[model samples]
Target: MIALIQRVSSATVTIENETVGAIGPGLLVLLGVEKGDDQAKADKLVRKVLAYRVFADADDKMNLNVSQAGGSLLVVSQFTLAADTNTGLRPSFSNGASHQDAEHWYQYFVQAARAQGMTTETGRFAADMQVSLVNDGPVTFWLQV
Candidate 1:
């Protein structure tokens, strides 16, 4: 499992002009499920996303985790994150999981995050989503498990 997390002041996902998911003062999580990824990987990645310290603290240091900063999470399924673009102009999806498998793990990850008492929102799986965000500090991280 892979996650590209961005600290954001606000974020939203729209499907056909309908706002499907939105958040304020949160992390926008672009989640990807690769071949061979499973529930354990999803669980580990979710734990890391919640606990990874990327928020600024009282001393103006990036030492606070999302939960500690009282931030919500907007998780979006993005298989493109697994694209193998290292070799050619066109990216390959050879490393990405099948749609069915990816969706299963994606949902499991969201449920696990919510189960951990985090404020979580999500984009519809397989939907043509338009995601918008005000990236605070433009801070981003790529995490994998």
Candidate 2:
């Protein structure tokens, strides 16, 4: 599993002009499931994401994790993150998980985050989504497990 995480002051996900999920002062998680990815990977990645220290502390140092900073989560499925772009000009989806497997893992990831007591919001799996965010410090990280 992979997560392209961005620290955001605010974020929202829309589908067909209807807002599906939104968050303030949190992490925007662009989640992707790859071939061979399973529940263990998903669980590990979720733990890393929430524990990632992108938020600032009293001295303005990056020292606080999302929960310690009192932040929420906005998770959105993004199969394209698994794209293999090393060859030619086109990307390959061969490393991506099947639609059914991807959706299952995506839901599992979100539920796992929520179960950890983190406030979580999510975009619909496999839906056409429009995501908007104000990237805090423009801080971003690619985490995989």
Candidate 3:
């Protein structure tokens, strides 16, 4: 499992011109599941994401995790993140998980976050989504487990 997380002041996901998910002051999580990714990997990744200290603290340092910073989460499925781009110009999707597996893990990840009492919003799995966000500090990180 992999996640590309961005600190955002606000974010939203739209499908067919209808807003589906939105959040204020949070991390925009672009989640990806690889061919062998399972519940354990998903669980580990979820824990890392929630505990990552990207938010600024009172001393003006990046020391606070999302919950402590009073932030929510906007998770979006992004299979492309698992693509193999090291060879040739065209990227390969051979490393990505199957559709069913991907969707299952995606939902599982979201539920795990919510189960931890985190405010989490999500993009429709396997849908054509349009996402927009105001990236706070333009801070981003690529995390994998």
The number of the candidate with the highest lDDT is 3
- Expressed as tens digits, the lDDT of each residue in 1-145 for candidate 2 is 8999999999999999999999999999999899999877988999899999999999999999999999999999999999999999999999999999999999999999999999999999999999999999989999989
When sorted by TM-score, best at the front, the candidate numbers are 3, 2, 1
Local lDDT at 95 for model 2: 99
Query: lDDT tens string, model 3, 1-145?
Result: 9999999999999999999999999899999999999888999999999999999999999999999999999999999999999999999999999999999999999999999999999999999999999999999999999
TM, every model? 0.98, 0.99, 0.99
Off by over 4 Å in 1: none
| Global lDDT of each candidate | 0.96, 0.96, 0.97
Candidate 2 lDDT score relative to the true structure: 0.96
Global local distance difference test of model 3: 0.97
TM-score of 3: 0.99
lDDT of 2 at 109: 93
Residue-level lDDT tens digits of model 1 in 52-87: 999999999999999999999999999999999999
